[model samples]
Target: MLLASIIMHAAQPIRKERSAASIYHLLQGKRSAQTLQDAHMYGLTHLFGIYPKLSRQLFDQVAASVMNEAERYENQDIPYFEGMTYQTQTESFLYRLLLLIQLLSNHVREEKRYIPVTDNPAVKHWIKQWYRQEQHRLDDWRNAIYKELYDLLGKLPPLQAALFVDRLTGYQHIGLTPGQLAGKYNIHETDVLLYQTSTVHHLLHHAENKAAIFPYLAALTNQPVHKTRTITSTAQKTRTMLERGLTLDQIAAVRGLTENTIKDHIVEMAWLDGEELSRRFLSDTDASIILECAAGAGTKKLKQIHALLDGKYNYFQIRLALALRRGHGVEA
Candidate 1:
């Protein structure tokens, strides 16, 4: 029985080709003689099933107007044939309008519309009130679609459904190409595209169920805590060496790496050597004094000693003269 119903539904083709002249010709004779009930039934059976319910509402509303105009054409109160022609024209306009609406809905679903929070009180208040009213309906729709899709494809290997939602919504939010998102997540681009299509249907049905989707999305995209900690430690070390008057080359040599590599590290650490030192070590008077002391000691024996005291003494406290004149103390 289900199979038969599916076949019957599939057999009903959605009429896509449309033109004003074509619509006028189709409705010319029917308007003057057709009953509203007959028109409604014909339109519902022919068009309504192919589209979503919201679209059907628009179609029915326009159809109702056509029915009223047709009644006027039947009365012959306005020039009989001209009234019939005008009714045909109106129906044609309505048909095109409905087609345009469907195109827009598809575009919106594909593009993933995001409404921003507005500062205007009226807009904010209205959205809040509207959400309160529709929240339950949205939850119900989300649950239904999630269950339906799970039932259909759940037998496949357990791919993270939350991750799929994240990729879909991220694409919508960030306008990333499927290929880009796939690369970021280490998945196939085709999989991302497929998930995007499935998500569109789910979003349309459960427009209000965005809450659960975002939490999962955050988890999928969130930076790993350990990675963040490692980066932070590297940054702290870079800044300390930089403040201690270590040139990029010197730091690189000390770390036994290339100068460019050390510069890259500093860049990632958000440090700007000699140009804009980070605020992290900006207030450390000890660091500032040490850097000054070592500034001119780059080639002398004192330079080697200063390097030894790298993190220990401030520049002013290093006593350069005392060290240099150690064996010639009374020769002043």
Candidate 2:
């Protein structure tokens, strides 16, 4: 059953690679600018998924460059568009950078080639030959480019830098881009992004330590502690009420206790006899009145009973003694 459910839910979204030719076609005409810009933003969001923190750093660098450009173009005489220029330019530059990064990241994410590394002679010989021929420099090259982009973005204001990074890195948690997550999850894009970001943070922190991971996993899986505590507290309350003068029927009426269980507790505590305690307590006017008064009796009555019982007698003995003193027959 579990395997079937897992298989049924294992579906991942099919992502079509955006080819350079297709992008070039879109960029050819006047109406193509907006289409290209949208495509770039989509790619940037995906790039963040591949390397969240790194992508964010690069985004900030692009934003800083745009801000510097905006500052140069600013007209102090015309205040209306001066302040808005930086934001507009920065957004445009960020979108373009995101597209380029996405293209590179997607290629890496889809790559299937792998060469095993082992201590065996044949594998070691193969690796040495491959390295000497420089057959797989893509990893090193990609890392260098990513680092360069990040180094450039490190100049923006802390808040702007953080926001730029989050925009890209935040989609990985939900395994979807902000737009796709929002549409599929039936929530706002921002909400899906934030949740994904939070999940990443939690997973990162917990991954470092087994103790931390266990507690987090337990919480997610609904651990038994919370349920156990609730049940124990409820039982304690029920025991306390039974010890106080609340008859089983009255306790049941007030606390939603069942009649059979209440009788069992009364018998267990030796407050009433094993057989027909409910009938006797209910049918006898004097016993019923005493039980009712007991329900409202102070802790002093409990203390008195406790003192009378001491070690020589239990609660049952004290109750029998009290009944005899009051001229009430036990047989009744």
Candidate 3:
């Protein structure tokens, strides 16, 4: 799964990748509506990630209301998003759900209040012309995607191809629900869903492997490609300190932080860099020892690992090894 996840690499859109503070300012410092939308959005891109099935008792009428409002305003300008154009029918639906959830959450959190976004005018005169232009280009985009899919299916074994073909129908390539496809194939529902997801992961990467699909993928996830997960401010500083050849204690003192804190940061840096977690911070021998200990423990719990190693490796060294083994919190 991890290998498949990183086969394609692309920079996420500036809009999707903007910091939380930037999002607040973008919406003109509103009641965290954009931030809230971002929270739900993490699920959109990881279509194959593990999430608990929503229980019937937890279903909200707000979702139904949002979907209703979305259908009502389809192809019309939405006041809630303040006329953001990247928003298409699907995006508006999700955004509407976020908006209603925000209202309901705020009402529950503090006092009665509603935050509404002002609507801007649609690009009226040029709207149809622009849409027609997009409609024309849409064919080129579809052709590119289909070409890649065809090539991928061509390379796949027959069983996999057959499993995948069942998902598409007619000239339009409409998608079938997993339950429908599962029944057709006489396979477990889970197996059908998993197989479809595996093929999709392959094709998505094939389509996106060459370049970052900005608004195209952004329109789907509403979240960035998440550059920060692999590198951070403290990690950056740690690298610079190591470059200066300053020892951990010396760097910690200079930076006005505890040596332990500095060590933790160094380990985090290692985690970010994977097997390349620089020899300067963690020697090859020390890292190997930590890795061996962790594998034996079969868990990443700091104390359990610390105990298993029996003082051979410190907490920080153990952590760095764990990070490297776990692919260092990176998708690519």
Candidate 3 worst ten-residue window by lDDT: 2-11
Q: Which tens-of-lDDT digit does each residue in 1-332 have in candidate 2? A: 11111111111110122332232222121122222222222222111121112233433443344345544323322101111112112222233334333433554676333322123454345334534654356465456546643543354334333444544521122123567645654655443433433333232223223434233222222122212211123445656886686765788888886866554344332222322443343334543443333333322133454453354434433332333222121221
lDDT of 2: 0.34
lDDT of each: 0.35, 0.34, 0.44
Residue 321's lDDT in candidate 3? 62
Q: Write the per-residue lDDT of candidate 3 for residues 1-332, one digit (tens) a residue.
A: 21111111101212224443322222221213232222222211232121113222322332233334544333332111111112122223223322323333343355444433213223222223434555446445444435544667776656556777665532323445668877777765655544544554444443334435322322223233422343336657867988888888898888898888777666655544656654655687887777676566444456876887788777766666655654322121
Highest lDDT against the true fold, candidate:
3
Pairs of residues clashing in candidate 2: 56-165, 61-153
How many clashes in candidate 2?
Answer: 2
TM-score for each predicted model, relative to the true structure: 0.20, 0.19, 0.41
Q: Which has the higher lDDT value, candidate number 1 or candidate number 2?
A: 1
